[model samples]
Target chain A: MTALLQVEQLEVVYQRAITAVQGISLVVQPNQIVALLGTNGAGKSTTLRAISGFLGLDDARVTEGAVRFKGERIETLSPQDITRRGIVLVPERDKVFPNLTVAENLIANAPRGMTLAERRRLHELVHQYFPKLAELKGREAGYLSGGERQMLAIAGAIVCGPALLLVDELSLGLAPVAVEELTRRLVEIRRELGIAILLVEQSAAVALEIADHGYVLENGRVVLDGDGPRLKSHPDIQEFYLGGSGERRSYRTVKQYRRSRRWYG
Target chain B: MQLYVNIAVLASIYALIACGYVLIYRVSRVLNLAHGELMMLGSYLLLTTASLFTGHPYLAFAAAALLALVVGALVYLFLLRRMTGEMVLAAVLTTVALGILLRGVMVLIWSASQQYPREALGWANPAIALPGGARISTFALLLILSTAAVYLSLFVFLRFSRWGIRMRAAGQNPLLAAQRGISLHGVYALAWGLSTFTGGLAGMLLAMDSGLDGTMVVIGLKAFPAALVGGLDSLVGALLGSLIIAAAEIFLIHHVDPLLSDVVPFLVLIAMLVIRPWGLLGTKEELDRV
Candidate 1:
């Protein structure tokens, strides 16, 4: 299958200091859930942001490489331009328009210039995916729970009907039940809408559980990239992730590991 | 009745200018201290337009609006675009620079002498008598119509249009708006263009009210009181606040003490800041930002 999105040797630098994501390369196949996992500030977010064209103190001025979305060079495109090309990114920090109502937030940055009926129909699909948002359609987004805000932020991006959806984190500060529900809906969105997804997650277990293909990022490079289950059992992965040298300690019996698994479950 | 009529007339003019300031501030978040200078530039645009040296009156008015539009675009690109500051003080200072540039240009074009746009076309200046026994000039009628036209179209465009949605979203959350694929540059450019157009309308209306003069630039300051009273976040607030400000200004002049006239609007501003803080209809979230 052709890669839906591909980044080759992409490098992002801040001033004289290079947060060198040295020679990192990755591919997101069509309709696949690709997870990027790493420790805090592991350059996983840098790569995602570079791909998304988020122009802040950071941007997509690759020191030496390219990012292609749907076979087009999207490296230096504006965030808005990237969205128009059918790749929408929901950044970290639940960046919802807190003052806008949920329904308004969903439609605020919607694909502009569509017919009214078409826009409304699209709104319906978004509401269908996140019923919690629909229930609070008229309420200010700032009042939403953290999980709900995350869900609404995702809904806002996905409603654009993108070919690929990039999510920063879906389970941060969320209840386990809610996380499971969100993961289920994301899976539903993939299967039901055939949208490819690229996710940046801190939780290796949660990401692998839902992902088809996964990559582990360390510092600023892809340390591991392959099938989820294969990487899950890899020795270095087990050491770095599964608490080095501990044998098959099932999370159900281990309360210490359970803290890392699920909050409610 | 005459006093009430004057109040209404003044309010309408205030609304026209207030809308301009609101738009520029919303997207750029810059006070556009030069906003008054834009108003000054609009008067010049109208003066040159009315001179026509040749064309008809309606043609002149249209021409003036078009010229103001260009001036507005240039201001955004050259003067206001690269302006970024640690706090708003930097942006406000840039606006001050823009204001100085415009005033200098105004003197360059029209000289330091006071002037008014020529009433080349006979369309305005015709007379009308109100049922309240107040005689209103046809110019007042035109001012009322133009103000309504601009405000009504703006209301509809913002409330129901796509660009308006994008513009409003930019004001609410520029970072998130950018994430959704709304070009931040495009948003800023559009705001400047639309708001500058309002400045022209306000200039034309104020010219119609009395006459275009250097002092006429003060209309921008007058709009501040109007905008603040209406809640800077709201387009409707501009109009509502203008009416309140204008009525008070006119009444203070007519009833209480004429010397207290200029003081009235600021007093209202102090009262609102003390009392509602959200103006009449501005949202709590917006007030928090202020």
Candidate 2:
């Protein structure tokens, strides 16, 4: 079967001089949670932005690759048009309208191809996933806790009825308990809605816990890629990302490990 | 009591005009310096429509209102659209240039004559005496009533309607709004339309009460300081600001010198700026955000 979403050797450039993402490729199958893990400036967020058609705001562009949604080229589409095409992104920051009430934030989403009745039903369904939101429906979103704001962000994206959801930095600024709860909710959302998610994160442990497939990025390139179990146990991921190794490896060995492509091939 | 009634009428006029500034500024962060010119243009359109739709006062008024809405939307579409991603200062300057151009064009067309639209529409500005020994002109009463209706409807619409919520969302964060599948251009165009429509209504009634000429633009300009004093982004602030400035203007003209009428609003504006630059109800963060 064909992939639900595909990014082929995508290259993103900022301000015509800085190339933030260099020839990175990935895919998400139907109902799968695919995690893109990288540290600061590793191009994980850029790749997601490129895929979700959100790079325009930052003067960034996907210069040398194709982002395909269900076999259709969509790299040139506007963000709202991309959303209408069923790929909605829950951005890293400023995720909810601060002044708007919680219920207004949920209803602000212009759902793709959903009737008013269907949209209301979807709102109720999302409220079920986060009952706390229902209770705080009338309260301003600005007054929400960080975890509740994250919940509202995710629920707001869910309101769009997306076929492919792009989540950027799901664990950033979140406590471990909150991250765990969010990851659990994500897994349940994938199972119930059958929506594919391309989750970009720096928290490898949290991401790998629920991701069906995973890729590790370093310096704008995908250095390693595999299924969750395989990548989780890889020594490099375990050492650098998962923080499993206590003893420091020699710098020479680390350089040699990066140069070797035996495991990637 | 008469003085208070006069102040109320003047305040309603300023409030009506100031809300237009608040609307466009809140959405796009553009000052729309041409708003006074646009407001004058609205009354001029009413004049032309009044002549064409002879003996049909209601029809002519409605037509002129609709035309004002289109004119505003067109201004955004043809001119302001290009400035969307430009610097705010440049956008504001563009509006200033547009205002000068509009004033020139209006002078050319109308010959700078003070025309009474009430005569064209065969309406009389009757003086109605209040029980409190105050008198209100017919158009002044309509202006006050229309201002109340506009404010109430705008309050409800912005709070309850889906698109209204979307407009507030867009105003707060344009990027997030676009990501949520909102068409920014559409929201902006709607705001411009509604703003110009309300502004036109104020202009038409004001022209009926007195008359319209280049001086009407000065009143429009005076009302802008009211918007800034109240908070450039808040409609309720505009109302309050208008009342404050109008009270100052009315009291100074009545008690001190009538010539002070032209300078009183700005004096109050300066005072507000010294105390709180963001206006009474405006968000402080908005100062840097703009």
Listed in order, the DockQ scores are 0.48, 0.82
Interface C-alpha RMSD after superposing true interface residues, each candidate, one decimal: 2.4, 0.9
- Residue range A1-265, candidate 2, lDDT tens digits: 9888989999999999999999988989999999999889999988988888888878999889899999999999988899998999999999999999999998888876689899988898899999999999999999999999999999999999998989999988989999999999999999999988999999899899999999999889988999999999988888778777687889997788777733463
Clashing pairs in 1: A80-B181
Q: Considering only N, C-alpha and C atoms within 3 Å, which residue pairs clash in candidate 2?
A: none
Q: Residue B282, candidate 2: how far off, in angstroms?
A: 1.0
List where candidate 1 sits over 4 angstroms from the true fold. A18-22, A58-65, A70-73, A110-124, A131-139, A234-265, B53-55, B84-88, B112-118, B124-127, B267-290
lDDT of 2 by residue, B219-258 (tens): 9999999999999999999999999999999999999999
lDDT of 1 by residue, A1-265 (tens): 6689999888777664766577788999998999998888678888888888873445335677899987889887777788888888887884797766787787677575567787677688878888778789889888998888888888888767688999987777889888888889899999988999998888777787888998887667776777988878866667556565876666565555434332211
Can you tell me the CAPRI class of model 1? acceptable
Specify the poorest-scoring 10-residue window by lDDT in model 1 chain A.
A256-265
